[model samples]
Target: MTSSRSDTRSKIVDAAERLLREQGPTAVTTRAVAEGAGVQAPTIYRLFGDKDGLLDAVAEHVMATYVSAKAEIVRAASADDVDPVEDLRAGWRAQIEFGTANPTLFVLLSDPERARRSPAARTGMDVLRSRVHRVALAGRLRVGEERAVELIHAAGTGAVLTLLSTPPSDRDPGLADDLFDAVLRRILTDTAPFAEDGPLASAVALRAVTPALDMLSDAERQLLTEWLDRAISAASPVTR
Candidate 1:
């Protein structure tokens, strides 16, 4: 596409994302996105084909950003040698930190409707999941092929989402660390030395947020902690 066309498309996708985050997919009309983007309604159709097309573009854009970053973190965490469980903990923390830092983008990336509508978006998450599966199979973690990988992903993502949506005063910042340690301790080797370490451990502790944790606000941090509490409290079949 031409430079001006690409720029307009980017604006439209951004506007659509903003609308979806604010009002949800049903409210993100093409005309509305166009108006919000300062483009003509017909131009939206010309560029994206229709409303579904626009939504697909927007979802793909956000999902690309989220999945790519997540995959990188998982890949990086997999390289650590302290303990497989600690590496796994590092991976989980990275994932939570990412989602909590970008709550809107995380939701947009995980939207079921968007997955059904966009192959690129669906495949992006699939790639990330596949990496986690590989790690589990490699014995870096305790997840088996049956459903553990999915469960772990669900738990982690749900935890982060709940935390991001909750109020600061209602949360405890230390819960996520505690919950992560508990989960990893359950799945990782019980006899491992790194498993006993707490927040000070370099292997499991998020010393650096990869890029930076500075993007997150105080409220977002509080919400993330609340979500972690819920995730940690949830009863699982494994526990049963």
Candidate 2:
């Protein structure tokens, strides 16, 4: 009985996913999905609650597969010793492509309330956080890991939305790349700075690994962390 119920749910979700992908969100009505999945409309209501509930299930299903593929790519790149900064760029480009290609899904996930509550969106953010952490370990990130992730995410989403608003033929091919570079400039150092007065980048990098350094006593580590935070704050760029 459990297996049969699960199968019914999968059929409905699969049908909804196809309708969303092929004809956009408006085509994913409960009646249409029930017809596509060869089930009665009440079956969809019993399984998914409503149209919004069904759409959420479809988003979760599709994005789970997409995020899993991206996770594998990141894992492979890390195992191969790809440059952390380059890997980050690759991830950024992949996200842009995904958003542009599936504008409907992208817009659905873009809803602030939905995005904040979404498991799939949180998984994607976790992936971004890991990539940013890698860059910080490499001494390339200039800002704190959380700040860098937030900046990159906002910039990438904005870039995709801007491009989507433009006609395909009239869209600037370099817009996304240019925006990415601009973000990189703000949040990452081209090279690790070793100077005494300009040790902010190094301080930020060291802070990421401080807990792993067993050589320092807890008190000593605390002192170092305080000092590093002051340095990082002093050197951080002021945003309007």
Candidate 3:
């Protein structure tokens, strides 16, 4: 019985996703979804509560599908063989493609409230965070991992939205790539740890590995991170 119910829920979500993709968010009425899925309107409410709830499920379904494919690609790549910065660039390009391809779903998930509540969004972010951590571990990151993640996320999200807002014929083909390079310039070091301002470079490198220090308590790590950020900022003219 549980399996049967779960199947029914999947069908409804699948139908809603198709409708949303084909006709946009405005067309995803409960009645339309019920007809598409061959289920009663009450079943949608029973399983998903309301239209907003159903939309949330649809967003999750689509995002999970995208993330799963990307996860497979990441798993297939040998970590030691991959350049972390290139890996990050590949992921960023994938995100841009996904967002532009699914404008309706992208806009829906753009809402801060919805994004915060989305399991799929969280999963996507976790993938991004892991990639950022890899860059840090390689000593290529110029800023704190969390700050780098936020900067990348914000830039990517803005680029997609900007492109979507423009008419396709008028959109700049290189805008996304330009924005990504700008982000990289801010977050990444050109060379690893031996350039001018060696102390700042060393501090940035150490901050990246702080999470792996088993001797430090959570508070100690946090405090250490703060000190490192301050030292890094003070020593680096670019960051000051």
TM-score for each prediction? 0.58, 0.91, 0.90
Candidate 1 lDDT, tens digit per residue, 23-52? 877779866887899999999989989887
Task: Give the number of colliding residue pairs in candidate 2.
Answer: 0
What TM-score should be assigned to candidate 2?
0.91
Clashing pairs in 2: none
lDDT of 2 by residue, 1-240 (tens): 999999999999999989998998889988899899999999998988899999888888878888988888888987898898899999999999999998888888899988988898999999998889888888876677778999999999999999899999999999999999999888877563454323667878998898788999999988888887777776776331
Q: Which of 1 and 2 is the better model by TM-score?
A: 2
The deviation in Å at residue 33 for candidate 1 is 3.9
Q: After superposition, how far is residue 71 of candidate 3 from its true place, in Å?
A: 3.0
TM-score of 3: 0.90
CA displacement after TM-score superposition, residue 174 of candidate 2 (Å): 0.7
TM-score ranking from best candidate downward: 2, 3, 1
- Scored against the true structure, residue 214 in model 1 reaches a CA lDDT of 58
